[model samples]
Target: MTTAIIKPQWSPLTIALMVMGFIIFWPLGLAVLGYILWGEKFGGSPEKAQAYWNKGKAWCSSNAPRHHRNHWNRSSGMSSSGNAAFDDYRAEQLKRLDEERARLDAEIDAFHEYMANLNKAKDREEFDRFMNERRGSRQGYDQNKPDNGDNNNGWGSNNA
Candidate 1:
């Protein structure tokens, strides 16, 4: 009988490092930093590490926002200049976008008008007659030929 051998179960070393981290590092900052840094080395993929950090950060922020207040703020907070120049820049961008949209709309309208004029322009019989006349002038066909094969349907032996 054959027996199957199971590989050792994989477990992340993050928890142990985190515990030791709390012991050695002042304010447990190193522990958190180590978790972030060596998480992939221990057993996590970069994606998994990122996900774990994101979830952990969220939980930590909720439970103790003031605990790692600096890290928490750096991660979550946003800063933007409230200057008049910034507001003007935004206004200019919006105005340019609006102008571009208006120009595009006008171009679309012009194209539609051009297409409508083209579509309503000509009779099929008139167009065919014009083409046949053009071809005859260019080729100079033998008028005396019986042309029975061509039969005025625009094809076959001129002698016919």
Candidate 2:
């Protein structure tokens, strides 16, 4: 006597609910679809659910890449492989890689600063050209104006 409305079977009610879930929110729809496909494996029990989770976890760990699997050991530097020579070699390589990464980071910073300076110079050049053109236009306009000392501000007076 399970009270769950959504079962793993492809009944009309389940299909309708799945479609409605998708229409409302896509992730909800995807969840419903997942339940429809794999609900029987969980079996509506806590122990079954836990077992399923553990199985998936084991699969993921087993399928991970070699470097990823050894990431913790490499990063912590506390694990030894029982070979002194190999350990020394690995330490030396890691140190060299760190130094190289530092050098590259410094170069990247220098390049960014150079680009910023170049952009500033270009903007300054454009601004100087604009100012010069503006000054030239104002000078030309002033030179073309009549020198007659009338205070009408560029508009001629109607009184002759």
Best by lDDT: 2
Writing each residue's lDDT as its tens digit, candidate 2 over 1-160 gives 5567667878998888899999999999898898889888999899999999999999998999987878867677647767999989988998999999999999999999999999999999999999999999999999998887878887878586
Model 1: pairs clashing at backbone N, Cα or C within 3 Å: 148-160, 149-160
Residue-level lDDT tens digits of model 1 in 67-130: 4765555445522336778867866886899899999999999999998877767566678889
- TM-scores of the candidates in the order shown: 0.28, 0.59
Best by TM-score: 2
For every candidate, C-alpha RMSD to the true structure in Å = 16.7, 5.7
> Per-model C-alpha lDDT, please?
0.63, 0.89
lDDT of prediction 2: 0.89
